[model samples]
Target chain A: MTVSDPTVGELSEGEILARILARLSPSRALLGPGDDAAVIAAPSGRFVATVDTLVHGPDFRLAWSNGFDLGWKAAAVNLADVAAMGARPTALLVALAMPDATRASFVEHIADGLRAACEALAPGCAVEGGDLTVSDTLVVAVTALGVLDAAAVTRSGARPGDIIAIAGDTGVAARGLDLLFSHFTDASGTPIAISPAALRSLSDEDGTALSRQLRPFPPVALGPAAASAGASAMMDVSDGLVLDASRMAVASTVTLDFDRQCVGDDPLSLSGGEDHALLATFPPSAVLPEGFRAVGAVRDVGAAPVTIDGEPYDGESGWDPYRDWDSARG
Target chain B: MTVSDPTVGELSEGEILARILARLSPSRALLGPGDDAAVIAAPSGRFVATVDTLVHGPDFRLAWSNGFDLGWKAAAVNLADVAAMGARPTALLVALAMPDATRASFVEHIADGLRAACEALAPGCAVEGGDLTVSDTLVVAVTALGVLDAAAVTRSGARPGDIIAIAGDTGVAARGLDLLFSHFTDASGTPIAISPAALRSLSDEDGTALSRQLRPFPPVALGPAAASAGASAMMDVSDGLVLDASRMAVASTVTLDFDRQCVGDDPLSLSGGEDHALLATFPPSAVLPEGFRAVGAVRDVGAAPVTIDGEPYDGESGWDPYRDWDSARG
Candidate 1:
């Protein structure tokens, strides 16, 4: 809208990339961004890699999230996946597809958010290489790579007597999502910005929930700590505690039972998503890591993969991208 | 269309993933798709990584390309970047964002295409991990990782006297694109399928051009071979010889002078894009790699980064996603 901030359509790819590189932290890779491909040191002789994508309509609404929050959340989610494998993230490759009409400043903000998230949540992790292309939709696809200091803590290693634990906030992001749907949309379900008066009047819990939804800061450092302390199975809780736990249980050929009191008997706590909490199973005699707290215990193969208080309690099963996305509302 | 081939929206994410995995090659990484992230071997202590994305509208037209072609092109483009670094691609992380109504069978074909490209171009590379999300527009974002046995080749390492060469076709794919625009579109410029009669009537060169555009099979293994043969600098020619050579020249602080006859005097050969050719500079005394052919030579920094027979040549400069995309046309 201003003379200084041009739409991307007015510039060249080189100019936009230069602008982005200027905002990012200096590369610490063996070879960095100016080249066709970046070379990163794989110190452990192996590297953990994963990719996650954030699409404009289905993942977030511009009314609720700014460029900064979107970028930070994107990096946080993928970094959590790497952390869940007991690795310290070292590099990121970001592929961004945006409409040509998008502003250069907005893109710079996204770059800043990526750098900030890496510095605050996963130290020494910097974006090493990336691609930019024009698209009808705005998409951020990030690949996070890490070097493991210990054996990867997979979801298939749990035993019958292991204690199930969780690190970082659970259900809070779901509640934040709940508030947005309840208060931030118009009658036809179009998102509108949260009003200043409403922001001022929200409860402390509501404020925290809203913040969690917009910019989740998962406990990244505790993953390796849990692994070092002898976690048998581990995974990030993105699709709610129950849904992700069932996956772990199925992989391990065991049953997972959570105490209703410890996991918060609320449906959202059991089925909420986007929290990026690290969930792990530790042996009976193991001391829980500093950020982890025992929430339940693993059991022998039962009728169901997950149970609550000795029963097959059911609520929302959390997000299944194909089943949950309502294009009309999105 | 049938009970066995339901739309992806009718299935859970797990079901869709299982279907895709079944269509892909067996996993070769230390850990694969079932985990939070995959662990891949980095035998050389260094890994090359890069990401590229193709969006439906600006990147391709469904009427013109099927799911298989889409997947193959995505993998081929990213693989070329890794090869350009003088490394052998080992793994790919694919992030696919598609419409909810997309058919499950279509997704499977995409997986098959990805597998086929990797198998043909880089024998050991496989899809190790990926993310699937729902979007209004179809986007395929691929991240490729590789290991280097020789010192990683970079575009900045080219010397003034180095010989410039290319290992793949330049203007052929561009001609393929031109043909589609000229013959495959309706009066209003909307893409329509290539008619059977039109397909049957095409000449051999035109047919090859069409195939090149749809499913590019870049010289993946030759990148390392070029390096082994003492290539001083290397990069993939995605955006055309003139434009990409200009980049290498700038990065090396040198100028590139091309023999128009060797590189083809056609403007498209110099300015068109999406070729995925391996372009490199080698010591004048070094024997050219098997697949490579001399096209130019590096010179001291001159008025223009790129020249034709020692003179500044002007034509189309090649694609700048930000500047070239016409949203209305897309």
Candidate 2:
């Protein structure tokens, strides 16, 4: 909005890219940016690759989530997917589509967030290549690639006697979501910009939850450690514990029986999502790795895919709140 | 409106994915779709990677382009980038974001085109994994990965005495673009649905040009062939010959001198783009690859980056058609 801070439309793509590249970490790939394509070393003969997108809107992306939050969240989500496969992320390819009227400084902040997230959560992983395009809605699509340190940990490898464990927060992000909706919405329930006073009013725990919601730090390194520890099945828990556990159960053809004591008694912890935890099944004799705690055990197929303390969880699934969220999102 | 043909909103994401998977080719990766992330083999220890996006709009995407056309173009464009790196394309990760009201059949058609393009242009390649999300506008962001057979070619490898060659059509897609605007647009210049009668009126040459524009068959195989044949530099010519040639010149710190006989006199051949051709530079004594034809030669840095018939070309660059297309696009 000021003379010094020009909009992206006022400059060329080359200029915008130069500014962004300056803020990003130097590439460590075989070939980095500025070429027709980047060449990355996938030394183990195989690489894990996954992509995820974040689209902007009032109900979807929180109004208080700035450019940095959006960039970090996008990278974090995709990195979690690669990590869930028991791989150590090495590179990322980003595709950014935004309105031309977007401020150039905002784009720079996004670059900074991407670099910071990679360094903090998955060190040695850097953005090697990307695409920039114009669109009516702002969207960030990121592809994460990593090399497997061991065999890929798939969801279908769990055995009936395996021990289920988790390595990240359960419902802290969901609690942040609660605080966001409760405190950041206007009369119409649409998200609005955060006030400094409002942000300062949160309790220490609430503030921590909100911070986790904005910039999630999924246990990236724990994925390979779990695999090395002889984990059988693994998955990234983004759609609540019970919902994702049910998926693992279906894939492994077993039942996920969670102990209430380990999983916590909070309803949100069971059905709330966006935590992006690493859930894995280890042999009964395998020692739990650092940063991991036992949650429950895999059981023979029962009447239901998931149970809590010997009974089928009769409550709604984590996805029940937004089965049609993708369809209904603006 | 029909009972059998439901919209995407009428079905769950799982149901839609099933329909799409049924239409795609069988996965060839180490571990394909359905897992947390696809495991692709990079046998040579290195993989080439790039991402590109196509957004729906009037001036950007022709209204007459169908779902199949959109999918095919998306795959071809990304393939060209990987091929330009002098590598063989191995997999594609597509992120499709469309409106909720999109028809299920349309999505299936997109899947079909994705498979068809790989089969036709780059065999052994397939859609390895992707992400689906809801957006206010339709967009396809594709990430292409490839493995180098010989060595990765780059735009900066050109040197004096290198022979410039092209492996695909030039100006043909631009011709089609001209017809698209002339025959498909209304008075306000907004593209509309194609009229069958109007299409029938085109001559053979025009028909071929239009088809190439809709579904480009870039010389994907020729890229690795050029590299193996000892090409010094290579690139994908999506922006006209002179413009992209100028880029290589600047990158290589050399001047390009094109022979009128090989490059032709048509202005479109020099300045028009969207052909997705593989352009390369080979040693003067090196035998040109089977599919390539000599178009120019490389020289030491001069006053002009590009010249024709020993004189600096006065004609405009290919990007002259849309200097600010991205910034002005919706």
Candidate 3:
């Protein structure tokens, strides 16, 4: 039966898209609606592609999070993936599905968020195309395509004794999340004395942290730079320093040693996601480029897994979807 | 508040991706997860791209349309888009968002539908990457990429005095849709009985029609063929013949004349929505390719809009999203 309005809620994803497209400017876009597929001219032959999904509740608290961040995060995560691959993002395709009752404003803000993220990361990157539908759940999926000018750098070329370096700060984004959770809880619990000054500080901190959490500044150029500089292996510091280091080790079949003390207090580095920072392994003697911070060293793959200062430390690794979250729903 | 499921849906998109990477055969994909983006080696540099969106209720009736068709349709529409661009689809990125309560089987079956469509049109094209979110509505967004060994054709290249042609039948898909509506009279009357024999005939008619409707088969090879043959301009017939022709005329600043008698019994030509046959204008001296029917002629810009037999007949030009629907819900 065609219940135009399923009791579940508002407008179907298609309805929202129809509205979005009506006002959306696709002038910069090579091809728009009414075609089988949209065509974007990527002058650069080498294109980078990345995709990500955002589920309800787990990834976002609708109460605290607005439609904007949701859209921004969706694009940001995928863009980050492309950047980590050392590519300049060119276009994005976003897919969103929701109930029929969803407010038109929500969809608009989501589009705004996507626009903001695109402008921030890749100024000209536009929403080339995507799919939208109606489902029982609220899920946002985005796939971003990028262009690599020089060459694409992978994560499997680190040579032993290479210096492990990172661009951008660490951990602050994670700390900001802690603050956000506290604010959410406090706002939900008992209204705290949130002064304007305190709020301003929180806002500033959150801007930095949220940027790291929402739209990471992936070293898109750094990847090619590292590659050109004879970087053995390279990757984005997504999960955590120690955890991601281990990934390089495994991918390169080399042991990774992290100098725990060298791990900077850059909140963007620790627990920071969406930082879009690039981490790479260079020969110990190689001169680091600006923004590079030597955090650890690559070692030989021997009897043990990755370690901190020659010892296996009992600590949490990077974010694990299955083990870290109770639910991945936004 | 984060609701932890710790089960299948609990993992973040990245986390789930990591797990998927561990299970997937790496050889099939040049690059897997954990990088900024995945690099898919398109043995050929030329690729096809298409996109389509599916909304709930309006596009489908859950009672009559199963998850299979839903999934199949999502991929088919985009593939058709790619084909329309004169590219053989090779891969697809599926973006699905639904409520948290959506059953896992529903998602799996949707993937199955995509596989089925891929197998039917061009094997090896599968859901490469996508996004998922917990939306209030169900939205399925798909972007498909294809490949072309020869030249890439576009709508801007049609020239004056070119012969207008189309591949495959048209409008049958729209007729089948009419039959569907006739079968189920807005859920107000008795549903018609579809006999087995009649069903078989209908299946053939519908298969071709449905393929046109649900899964469009674009004459991708003809794109380069037309281009190499010095086609003035090219495009796929998406909006009705009249509307799409109008588009070509506007783009090329030319008037197109069609001999209605030359147009056979293919309902799609007159009034079809998804019959993804290739429509191109070639030099008068150019020989028509296989499966393509010379339906009309291109004229220099004149006062009249695209006409049939030198006259504008009053009928539905094509589908208009806002006007076609019976109503809109906030």
Candidate 4:
């Protein structure tokens, strides 16, 4: 069926499930959906589990994102968290809550997006199982399971004199979000409906930035590689470079110093969120992994947890979901 | 803090999480909360995973249930799914979404309910980690992980001539729900406000039924016991008995025949939902485990997937969440 066809309210739960499951192919699960539970092989003897939820109003706007984008972002964000733990994602369990009036094809497109993300970002990771329920708003909750191939690279492992490095893009998603906000809203900050054709006609640079926002490319492979390479500590740069670095510093009881010259003209690289880049600290003398670029250094425990270019950064730390909507808009 | 003190909007996400985490005591997970992901031991080399979502309007009503009740019910339902698989629950991951106006005390109570359930029902099980997000309505999504100690019992293992038995309450939750519905609504089906004191004054029998509806105690241990006892097939009766039995019959390619006398006076036993009982089929000569009572027998594949007393029995099958709201209310 096409994307605009039959609404889910017109079909039974069993039928919708059958259609969605048919579109998914699980490669890593011992036993996939259709059972009471899915069996996932955990040969490493330990499983790393993380869960994240995306709500429609706070996380995404239906006008700005389609089912495919929603599904892809959901998978990418969770997979990034799994990668940050220095593990390889093995399976994903999705629990979706949507209004009954949602189109059946929308759900199918979501499945397709999940499959595409798995194939592109973390091959062999499967959509093991999921639950679907009716709600007034759309909510996608993903619980990702991974296997630790090496010692877990926790945020608490950073030590004094460690060199900080990063893998994948930083601040791109934040830029994309800014562009979308501008394109969809009028001068007074009120939302104005924009046609799909108009959105497609935007400048190529804007289109590229929007894609980054809609579909982040987290460095899933580099996580385990860094872990194996003896990285001291690691985490995904989700909230923002400066804010997340502060978190790592506090966890490790050390101080993080980011070089302003290395961060470049993009102030966003220091404060933008949703980049999903791998941020790791390696021993000062250790050889850096291939994809990672040196951006900062770990210093001895100091008065402040994080600083930029030897001085404290006095700017917005990062995005906070609980902030008032008006303040968030600014 | 008391149950009615502070609203969640008064605190930042970090503050809320810190408060919630302080109340949780995790015994089964290798790592619980505070990191990118929680680590769960999977000594069996495999993990059984299941997820369920409870939406405010569709799955529950704040007018009738409290935060503690919501949390307890969420944990119980997911744990029951793990138990149905003949596995022991090891860890739980929660993804909660709610409006900004939600009370901090309410969230705390939910966490308390989750902790209480793990302590009381499945000792040693832990709330390993979770995600909290802002939404327009309340949604609780839980993903439970279990370890199979013995052979994993599936619904597709029943053979012809196997005796059908069940271990736990039947139709009680449905009856309890009916009682609650009748109490809160006028004869014309319009909602009428019922005071908490009046609700507390319900007859002992009615109170028992309501508790079953609000806090189901699934026969978790019996599932593993049935597996050890060499039961041929097993499943949880989450839906009504006939509908779920039909599912088992279809999976095993056998016909299930229930004796009317065995089910007794509660016709709801044959067609009610949320019982969370372990239903299994075993060889006729095998001794029934304690708590399991014979209810039927497995037969060769026939015209219909299920029958009662050697003849087809026609009645309303069971609950369907996707059914129209009015019909579902009935």
Identify the candidate with maximal lDDT: 1
lDDT of 2 by residue, A219-269 (tens): 999999999999999999887899899999999999999998898778788
Instruction: Report how far residue B109 has shifted in candidate 2, in Å.
Output: 0.7
The regions of model 4 sitting more than 4 angstroms off are A1-4, A186-201, A324-330, B1-4, B186-196, B324-330
Model 2 chain A lDDT-worst window of ten: A321-330
Docking class of 3: acceptable
lDDT of 3 by residue, B17-81 (tens): 44433432232345644454666554454344555667665565554455667787777667666
- Greater DockQ among 2 and 3 belongs to 2
Which ten-residue region of model 3 chain A has the weakest summed lDDT? A3-12
- Counting clashing residue pairs in each candidate, in order, gives 0, 0, 88, 1
Q: After superposition, how far is residue A109 of candidate 2 from its true place, in Å?
A: 0.9
Give the Å error, residue A225, model 4. 1.3
- Sorting all predicted structures by lDDT, with the top scorer first, yields 1, 2, 4, 3
TM-score of each model, in listed order: 0.98, 0.96, 0.77, 0.95
- Provide the lDDT at B202 for model 1: 95
Residue-wise lDDT of candidate 4 within B1-330, one digit each (tens)?
Answer: 654566666677788898788777745677778788888888888888999888887676776667888888898888888887788888899898988788888898889988888787788888998998888879999999998877678899999999999999889888887887888767876445558787788998788778888777888778778878889989888888888899999999999998889976466878888878888999988888899999999999999888988887688777677764432443
Ranked by TM-score, the better of candidates 2 and 4 is 2
- What value does DockQ give for candidate 3? 0.28
Give candidate 4's error at residue B20 in angstroms.
0.9
For model 3 the interface RMSD, in Å, equals 5.0
Which ten residues in a row are the worst by lDDT in model 2 chain B? B321-330
Share of reference contacts found in each model: 0.96, 0.67, 0.44, 0.81
